[model samples]
Target: MVKTSKTVGRCEEFTANDVEVLGKAPLYQGFFSMVKYRFRHRLFAGGWSEPVDREMFERGHAAAMLPYDPVRDCVVMIEQFRVGAYAAGCAPWQLEIVAGIIEPEEVSEEVVRREAVEEAGLEVGELHKITRYLSSSGGCSETLDVFVGIADSRKADGIHGLPEEGEDIRVRGLSREQAYQWVESGKIENAASIIALQWLQLNYRKLQEAAQDLPLP
Candidate 1:
């Protein structure tokens, strides 16, 4: 008998056409909707899989931004109470990058810019895209478009949020090193914050040089 190992590669052999969505039905509809999908996909070595039923939470999409003041070597972060964290048995108050849901037909950059002001009381300068990622691909239909926006950290303090929306956000400025340290120490738990800070760590020098070319505001 001989044992063989499968080769793992960067790209997969399967595409959407390989899967069939038999039917979809709404399970719950509220602030965020839930739906049940019946689908089947191609198997790794051969034929199709058995019909599968999965429930997916549909929260739409969102945009998140980490406000970096390259001139001051600081990053602005927001702290707020999140019900999701509380429900998950973690600390309710989370330190996170500014974020907001993207409404229909709204540009990602515009959504981040608006969220920056509403959540952190800071007006971002130039926008540098970081990445777009799914929040939870397994069970949620929420993709987040993340960015590192040039901002003035000096103006990032104070509590700011829309009262009508029940948001009470506290803004703080942290040195870039301290922010990254939080990521390393698990003090920053959200994916968006972690991704943004890690990216800034990798691209700090280039971002600083780019900031030098902008006119003083």
Candidate 2:
């Protein structure tokens, strides 16, 4: 076994300039694409490393929102069929937050609000940003922005989606505690859904305080 250093240096190489992109070749382009890249990066010890080649899946960025009504202490979640999960031999239908891809000219916040309406029939009010992260930097080039949006969760239960987009969604409302239990039970398996719900649990007191009055325009 190789023994590694127990201590590490400071993380100072924090920019694209640290790595050089030698070339990128498109492998496929459909709804999403695959690309091969050749590049090298600065070594932590000091010198630049050798060129390395890798392939990556490229689906554009997306925004996801968990609808919450602090006044009612409830949350909205959705269920939809995920082909990727089906292909992987997992359950084809997944429980997830309302989410949509960010179009080339659209912002994450706009996408989140639009998805809230299209997927759950909720008018997203004040959005509290939870986090932004790469879905899987090792293989996929998709960053996701997560938010908890203020909404009337009691009214958010129904089947809502755009048929033109081939979307069939079912919406459900659960008490905040029940939502978290679903997470712990592994029933809520989507990453964005899990993160958003966990964030709501952590910040619930603040959400209640904010909900005491209507958010301004």
Candidate 3:
């Protein structure tokens, strides 16, 4: 067994240069790719550790947004099928925020806005970034940028998403309180959805205040 020291501070002095990559190669390529990396890093206790091999899933980074209608105090959410959940022996369909991969040359905000339209049939305006996080740093290289966008929830009832992409999304509007309730009840299970909703819960009053002068849609 290995013992480690506990630290009180959040800041670490390690840099990317502290890790040395001896080799790397593609393990598989499909809708997503996997790569194997052999590397060693400087240890917190002392010297460099033994070279290690790890496989990384490379699905690319993504952007997700929760559309909030301040006038109605509602939020737009989407339900869609996710293979990962099915494989994990959980429910196949997931309640989630609008999200999409950030394709090459595209920005995170652009992806969020486009996904809102594609997944929910709703147009979003004035995105406020919530936070950015890694999906799973241990095995996946994907990161997600989360945001809250201004929208008119009355327009968000439909079945949308591109047929060619095998996407079938159901869009619905829920009161902000109701949505946060889902988060508390385990109904909203996905990370992006949970994070976005919690952020909304904490910052919604400020958002409502900021939108007060604007005319209701």
The global C-alpha lDDT for each of the candidates, from Candidate 1 onward, is 0.90, 0.87, 0.90
Candidate 2 pairs with clashing backbones: none
Which segments of candidate 2 are over 4 A away from where they belong?
Answer: 1-11, 215-217
Off by over 4 Å in 1: 1-12
lDDT by residue (3-61, candidate 1, tens digit) is 22243344446766677888999999998999999988867766778999999999999
Ten contiguous residues minimizing lDDT sum, candidate 2: 1-10
Q: Compute the lDDT of residue 30 as modeled in candidate 1.
A: 95
* Candidate order, lDDT descending: 1, 3, 2
**Clashes by residue pair, model 1:** none
**lDDT score of model 2?**
0.87
TM-score of 1: 0.93
Worst 10 residues of 3 by lDDT: 1-10
